[model samples]
Target chain A: MTDIKTLETASSPEKLNRVVIEPVTRVEGHGKVTLLLDDNNQVQQARLHIVEFRGFEKFIQGRPYWELPVLVQRLCGICPVSHHLAAAKAVDQLVGVDQLTPTAEKVRRLMHYGQTLQSHALHFFHLSSPDLLFGYDDAVAHRNIIGVLQDYPETAKQGVLLRKYGQEVIRLTAGKRIHGTGAIPGGVNKNLNQKEREFLLQDIDQMIEWGKTALELSISLFEKNLPNSRDFATNETNMLSLCREDGGLDIYHGGLRARRPDGSLIIDGIDYRDYEDYIHEQVKPWTYMKFPYLVAQGREEGTYRVGPLARINNCDFIDTPLAEKARLHFRAFADEGLVQSTLAYHWARMIELLHCTEAIRDLLNDPDISGTELITKGNMREKGIGVIEAPRGSLFHHYEIDEGGLVTRANLIVSTTNNNRAMNESIRRVAIDELNGRELTEPLLNQIEVAIRAYDPCLSCATHALGKMPLEVQLVDAEGHTVDRLYKNANGDVSLCKIEA
Target chain B: MIRHFTLDGKKIPFREGQTIMEAAQDAGIYIPHLCYNPEFVPHGSCRVCTVKANGRIVASCTTPATEEMQVENETEELQGNRRELLQMLFVEGNHVCPGCEKSGACQLQAVAYYTGMLAPEFTYFYPMRTVDSSHPDVAIDYNRCILCELCVRASRDEDGKNIFSIDGRGINTHLTVNSASGKLGDTDFDVHDKAAQVCPVGAILPKHEGYNIPIGQRLYDRKPISVVGDVADHQEE
Candidate 1:
């Protein structure tokens, strides 16, 4: 860590002349963005590197088939429930159970919605809310969760409570907030008790109102800064998500649906179990993460945006009335075209948050949640694939089991990995548009982060873990001499350091 | 007339040849023991049942219940030592409770909880162990073996199969099958063998039975191990 005195002597917020930026805030896990510049200060190349490596795929081998669901939760702390449920679905196939009992399905769905609600609430209020509530160019010190709590206490309070409510739902359904063993092979192990159902029902209405309030806040903020955000980090890319049989937005279970930037279907109603037939992961030597693209479009053009933006853009309609209305308005705002603005991710996320609340309420009202039937037994299968729309984007869990019921192979394409190329493109656009031929400023550096933050990538879950990831930035001339360097420790404190020639 | 021993300030009546654990069990006092099944001869291999007898730490299951003996079982210092003992047992084996089908029902996990061992303090051994699933009706997951020798005792004394034994000594110590092929499937041991049901952990599991009991409904889920006791203790009159 660079000392305060050394940092003060080297540079300050008012006069940041270095090319590097601070570590990204509000995102899960560690990542780095590098922009290669020419002598003319032109952005030559931009890349988002996943620096951590947790080889979960290799480690999960030889484990019992029944343990897959719980074991996979070790992949991500932010969205363990998503991984848990995905693995559960895959193990369900391994058990040769095509469908879960109504009670089991509803319990799992309720758990997933709670996960989506809490995850989105956390990212919106705690992580990205600070940047949005305070202008992007606001003082770095005052542009964080603490800053939001001090200035917008009511909004922050709602965010905390909404997140708490979601976690409570998870606890009652899944057994714990994180690394829960709720979902098991073939089906869930337990059903929602009447008491648990009522406990969640008590807050459904307030959570819905808060969800709407958050949606409104995001919309107003986006609209207020329409001009600046419209083209900021905007890249017209293809989008992908899971949609119901009737093309309704279904985050938990559905066939794969993908669309071009023009709202034309690239692929629709394809089984996600056959995902490898259409999708291929392209490996680059620079990072641990793999870039996934459509097989037909190839790597460069096939790279698509996912998560809130993609799900909202690709789905025909949202099932919930309130979220459907909001989705319609969102479409109207986009002139019935896909919303290409990166900043619109916040809006789409809140819209889904509202949808999750409605879905949660509906599920709680259903008597099946309290039904006794929880598990289904069937013949065992060899290969199993499970896909779900995680809080970030589409997540896939594929596994192969031996005759004796031990996992032989495991392959996981986490949500963030699907958006790898899109995140790089977002950073590239920001660097080209904002930082070209200019001295590095704190706010300009933050613009690069804001673009990537829109996708809400969990790099830890995507590439895996390695403790703290300190963000570092370096600049070199055409001849590649160390011109300048900046460093941001894990605490998000940025300091300029002189590279001794 | 019954002789008595003072255990943690409580007068525990005992028979002449009874061990402290036997006396404790008879008096409705639960002393956490993994390898001391009352159905077989007691082998104090696992030190989880260590109690202070006359100011000296000793295995309560093997120590004879002497008249006018003073024993301290539930002191804070004893509990802490027991926690350390349980932690060693945890770190020494690949006891992934979440992944194990026997998690909720296993006496090892139950006793660990009763002793307040939330997380292991020692560095994980991560020792490479075997899983013998060749048996049609039973499987042996050596990774979860605690070297308690309950299966060894149960097979020899009750089942009369002599199908299991401990192989290595010290840190390398592990349960070994007595078959020529060194696999449970090759042995004459059946799923109905007393050895099959005697493992304190997930070491010996019946094939095709995976998580039969839901987590909340498992043996120790509703109550701590002290209240429920081990299967042998529960079966004992």
Candidate 2:
């Protein structure tokens, strides 16, 4: 078991001097990290600022309840399946179906597994590998996928192949890999074909093996980069994920579970619709991202995390045999009941990947996966709520329909949005630790980025909106003035182009 | 006498007073369109079917087909313009195709496929269009409306209820119902009405049968927009 000790300090936002990394890179959305320092360059405040604005809430009014599933998925291409499924669950209540057909349920589950697998692979290889492989403080240009390829060509190929397998799973289950139209309001539009099944089945064993390989790789990373994995930032307050009644790793349909930093269950297996009873959202003026916390807990104190790390920590058991074994090893890493090291999120992701692949393999062997009955229709209702575990976190889609069954009001708490407070806190802590009153350098700035990246913070998805992101990090003085800025040039090098502006 | 016009290098014969769209349809060629339904009086609101004739752009559904016209229907330049028009439609409204029930059959999505425009080139407006689900059988999603006017024309000319009409100007132009309340249930627009059947987008949808047809088996999924007849020929009911 990993040793337990309080090896880090949290962020203290007191005075005004600031350092900023504008338009943060290697993350999904537009954001910046601002560090407030004292006169002696002592760290005071570190904040992750979300700059992009999207008014999805203002616009989606007056759409039909049945359209909610299709509309809300437009939030993020990276994890549209999560949004699509969550909204579909909400719409299912409006459609008046108590439960879906067995086949419909399995197909949806398959799609979810595919989504989780692909998204996890993407974070591990495409985004975070450069930092882990080349070292966070290495040359910015060499700390990316290209660098991974240059240093470890075979490893890069395996990453691409692993992602490709996941994509194929999506393409076979849904119509297209990204933004697929497979799941509808009541159930799904189609079921898997024998050919599609065979296509996935042929590669199932290989995928499981690759998943094991990936898991080993991730464990090695945590073992090697212990400081980066443990020390810099700790957003260990509380965690939330979905778990089955038996405490199995249930990603699609399950009750919500919330755990304390020690990994003891505060609440387990509660209906998702009751989320408001326990959690509340607090909006801050500095950023569009809202901080959701344990009800009445207040801002920083109420901070909790979602996503892979939380999911791994909160769950009691894994349903699948192989994944259960991997889960055991991951659990052993915890000194107490939870692993507070932000970098351990990468390890958590690999465990989920193993589970996803194993789950996919088992789901295929079941004959019911190809059933023809894909939808169930019933009397329409006026109000419905849907919740599902997205790759980033727990997602909720609630809609109120008129007598005509059209949506009058919609409120969505996306996965990333659930962790806004935690992400901000994590990035802040990382920034303060890496910058002990020194000038902002590429390596120091990257430490903060790695902290944010640990959450795989999908700001675009979290904002309930979507767009392209170009991020920059900067240094600021006492009166809130820009000292310097770091930008990613065309060659992927972090270039500080402008100064003293 | 046979009057011939070469469209995309194909000799397509046209009858007098017939628009380019009608001629192309008769010749088994699909010029991607959204608003120009054969049943309604041609209202070229959605310029998705715009074609270039003699170096000048014209709405194929409204412009009369003349003899021996050199029409550029399936060319790179015209298709590029059509892609932009589709992009404008996409960015202006909340046409979330992947989540839409009509995604597999939507004319906008189909034409987008036919034009090879994989994704929109502009920013999404993420309009907060309202959905009118107050009706018992049918629902109206304003976000998916391309302002094609097909619903308006069908409701007015065919159903004779005048339940729908054009309500705004310029980019603000929108579709509105004639009911005392803005809800669809308050209006006489039933699921069987031409207005409901005439929608080329997912804006107007039939309730309860959302995922009846599997996506890959849906109309546009099996055949491209170029092969299937226009929106009118592929009505769900």
Candidate 3:
């Protein structure tokens, strides 16, 4: 958890003279970083500050209990389904509806997998590929979807097609792709038909084939760049994920587990309802987002990462054959134990994508995919918690309701919040090691942004609706005199780039 | 005789045999709708005014008002259905929204625009259809018609013309001219009629004023039309 403090001149004379990177760039959401330096220009304290204020918690109060799923689903476009499912689970819990029938469970799992596959695929191919495949300083035009198509048309086409499959799965199961209407308190409202099942199966087969080829291409690219890419593997952080006791792949649903770099599970079967016990949230003066850290380890050593790398590290075995093959290849390079580096996360995401595709295929081919028993009737009475391993990390939704079925209380802890401590640590480490001796250039800035994006942080998901981030940087002299200052507007356009001796 | 029920937790009286929509309107709680007209017999085809009755969501336009029943308007499930229905309407129609002359005035576009539908979730079918410039004063573009049956309703109930009818099913179901000749000009259709003006999308555009009102100042330009209102008082019977 972050410790908020007001900077005082008398406390540390040397610290008064520092340079701060007020705003970070190339990210979806707004955040800042204060880099303190001594009189000798050496680094002092590096603090990553998230400076966006959104009150989704406060906004959702007094809303009808049943409406939460749709309301929360709009929280983030990238992970709308995650929020929807979590909200539904919470409602289900409040309604005292647990243990969905096999068919309903299978359909829910299918929908969940669709989101995971699409979201993970999007991050790997569109978001992260620019840094890994193309250089960080690649032109803006060449850094987006158009660029991907131009550079690798087949790969780009496959990515689009694969995403379509994932989206189609969501559409078929939920009735619509974005902000779907399927998952209710008891179960889903929509059911799949025979034609829809067949369509999904055919699409899944194509996606699986596409995923296999994409994996091979990605591995080859990584292999060719391994020696040069070694330095990218900088930050050493702890890993947290949801996994089974036997250490098999658990993505859609599972219990929480925390582990060190050596594959030793420190905390296992941590009930999501009791999440507040293991994780602690603290407020920073600059940002409304609460930084949550692992309580047992404390903030300094409590820095732990979640998402694909974390999941790969915590699990001993994978369910799918294709995923196991990818895992073997990944382990050959980074070892089988808990790998702490953020760069390895990309590989983990690819492995998971492969696994998700295979799993989706398996689920689609099941006879129950077209079952009529989709929604189960139930009454709302008891509070419940819904925990799922979203593509980015662990997602938890807890809700309390009155007997009348109106939501009295709702608490959501997204995966990105869980990685806040680790992200700060990673940023600091990269700043110290990569930026210490290097000149402040556009490439260096891009590298810094890439390091943060490596975790695939969903900033929009983190901060609900506080708009436009303003970035201000200040360089101070030994006497605490402002030597240089820079200001950037909400669109990340530098408004003032000035320097004073 | 009147039917009474709770709406959004408030109790109100509805006409004995009136639709839930009519009752809600009589109670001054406007339910968002597109197809239902007070003059027409309830069609319940659009599925936009779907509300929870006895814990199950159903179209309020067709469901009869019942005594002491609980009805939830604008519930999460209903909202989802409404949004999805709007999305389907947007994608299914040839509503080239930005360029349409009746964009603001069109009821289909009005409901969609008010609902905050920025993008269509489903893939655009982009079905093409020929515009019938057959009528002297009006043109019917089947592409942008959402099959809301508003035109059909107006023809049969309001104008007492019965010149419009719907054909097909599911996603393919669409409004067709009620003439064996299959042409608006060939049929006993008059462009000056209210049915022509009541056509929701640019599907039924005025032939003379094709590009007169810029898309922005169209149907919903001045104020939004209430879906349900005093329908009990305006009852045909």
TM-score, every prediction = 0.92, 0.85, 0.65
* Candidate with the larger DockQ of 1 and 3: 1
Task: Report every candidate's CA lDDT.
Answer: 0.83, 0.79, 0.70
- Per-residue C-alpha lDDT of model 1 across residues A326-413, encoded as one tens digit per residue: 9998887776568999999999999999999999999999999999888889998999999999999999999998877778899999
lDDT of 2 by residue, A90-200 (tens): 888888886999998999999999999988998898889888877888986677777888999878887888888888877777778876767777788888879889989
Please estimate how well model 1 matches the true structure, expressed as its whole-model Cα lDDT: 0.83
True contacts kept of 2: 0.67
Residue A481's lDDT within candidate 3 is 79
Residue range B1-237, candidate 3, lDDT tens digits: 655798889997987787789888877777878777776777787888899998888899999889998999867667777889999878877666543445455666667655656678898888866556556556677767878777787778778899899888887787788777787877777766668656546677654233322222334555554542221222232
Model 1 alpha-carbon miss at residue B67, Å = 1.7
Can you rank all candidates by TM-score, best first?
A: 1, 2, 3
On a 0 to 100 scale, what is the lDDT of residue A469 in model 2?
39
* TM-score for chain A, prediction 1: 0.92
In model 2, which runs have C-alpha deviations exceeding 4 angstroms? A1-16, A225-228, A296-302, A462-472, A479-488, A494-501, B1-101, B108-131, B141-184, B208-214
In candidate 3, residue A321 scores what lDDT? 94
lDDT of 2: 0.79
